[model samples]
Target: MNDLEDLPEKNKIFESDIFIKILTSPREAFKFINDYNYEKHLYILLFLAGMLRSFDRASTKNMGDNYSIWAIILISIIFGGLFGWITYYIYSALISWSGSWLNGKGNTESILRILAYALFPSILSLIILIPQIAIYGETMFKSENDFYSSGLVESVIYYGFFIIELILGIWSFVLCVIGISEVQKLSIGKSILNLLLPAILLIFFILILVLLFKLIN
Candidate 1:
């Protein structure tokens, strides 16, 4: 009887409320998530986020007339899932290592967990793609198709959905900053700096490599 009573307590670690809490009170949500190690659907979340990102990238380029919509989606799912997992580990490691310079307390696992949950907004943003695909089909991925010239109503719907997607993407970053701050025990400003540190170093390293290549040539 006591064991049965305790089951819910133990299983409550997997509660879905964290999804709602993450959006409403991110700091507390991240702290609880990190403390409890709530890692349910972590891979799925990352994979879907990666798919959305991949699809966005594909939409920008010309996919050509040879590819079908289903084929593109399949490729995005497979490649994007792989890319997401790889990038998640790399970014988490980079952030964890860089945070140490600022005396941060978070390790890679904790940062990874926080980042996974932080992507909730982006996962939700996937809904916007459905109607977009339904309306535009393969033309959505083709650069030659000018959507704006279609019609005012279609253009309005397209831009409206785009705006919502943009907001969600921005909010995902905001949640990321908040989660990092909670895990790293840094202020919001410092958290932003910690997040940017990797990109900054990568850019600097690329510039130096470019200079070296030019000199060698």
Candidate 2:
């Protein structure tokens, strides 16, 4: 509600629940929007979606339609691609109190963003997964499923995906900082630091991974 600097040290722009963080302070977040850079927040939403998709894919292989669990990967891909941009309108609609939009509410910009993110990633995922499915044909992702399903190897790969999603979120936050700071004429160094937060996190997680591998094997 106040200047960015005035927020508490623990206001925590990056968060575990991206939706909650963004949606929690919808008015404050919307104020970040400007005429020239409307799309900036879209990236933040996308990054959030990516993080969710990453975690859901890696951590929640056990839940929901596991019988056709391959669909989970496909759906996650769609969420990752589209939610980033799609969320901006969703945010705006909620802000405007457009209660009717939910019943077949579709804006061109929102639709375009959704189609772009969802379709591309979904297509790419299907491409990659088709081969994996054809090779391992009938098998599906399970928590104890080994390398194809789950294992040390799978853990590493999942970590890799989690890192990638985290990186995307950090990158989006940096862009937000840069745009907001520059227009508001704040320090560039501060923006850089926001981006650097992810690097520190990556190093910490990588260390965990190493220790985990050592323990398991």
Candidate 3:
């Protein structure tokens, strides 16, 4: 009989120690995921990614005059989690479907696992955001607040956090590309194409729709 330690990595999913691995050695992490079908934290990761995305949109677009900061945060977490869950599945499906055109091997489930793990850095950005919200309050999300004019020190801190968050976001994308490459069994170039093809096709479809609408009008 085989002992627990003698089992293959797939059978030892509970012992994988993937969270730290996903950040430090993403290629190996992705390889384990592809091999083991690791998906224990999928929902929470998707929810957090959604929340971060919602907060980003709120910062840029503002939440109108009626919402309080607490309300905004609450709404962002709940709705963003739902949106993230839905979009994660949609994106995985799109990537899988599109990648097949390049003779790629990954399916939607594998793509979903890759992306869920890839979101670790972006999720860490939430740690950076906590202090920004505490320091700036609603001004962080408001366009009329003249945020930078608060003080030189304040501006420096805000911008510093922003840069850190930006780096984490960029690193998240890097991880995604690396994870996709492993899952799809493709070169980095093809993995990038697999990732971008969905967006490119979506933009093209939208343009065609707009052209058709103009002609009809």
Clashing pairs in 2: 45-84, 46-84, 145-150, 146-150
For each predicted model, how many residue pairs clash, with residues at least 3 apart or on different chains?
0, 4, 0
**How do these models rank on lDDT, best leading?**
3, 1, 2
After TM-score superposition, what is the CA distance of residue 206 in candidate 2 from its true location, in Å? 36
Residue range 45-71, candidate 2, lDDT tens digits: 455455355434544555333545455
Candidate 2 — worst ten consecutive residues by lDDT sum?
Answer: 95-104
Write down the RMSD of all candidates, one decimal each: 3.5, 16.2, 3.0
TM-score of each: 0.90, 0.32, 0.91
The residue ranges of model 3 lying beyond 4 angstroms of the native Cα positions read 1-16
Give me the runs in candidate 2 sitting further than 4 Å from their true place: 1-67, 73-86, 92-154, 180-217
Question: For residue 33, what is the lDDT in candidate 1?
Answer: 73
TM-score of 1: 0.90
Task: Kindly report which residue pairs in candidate 3 clash with one another.
Answer: none
lDDT of 1 at 130: 88
* Residue pairs with backbone atoms closer than 3 Å in model 1 (clashes): none
lDDT by residue (28-70, candidate 1, tens digit) is 7887777767677788888887888788778876663658899
Candidate 2 lDDT score relative to the true structure:
0.43
Q: Rank the candidates by TM-score, best first.
A: 3, 1, 2
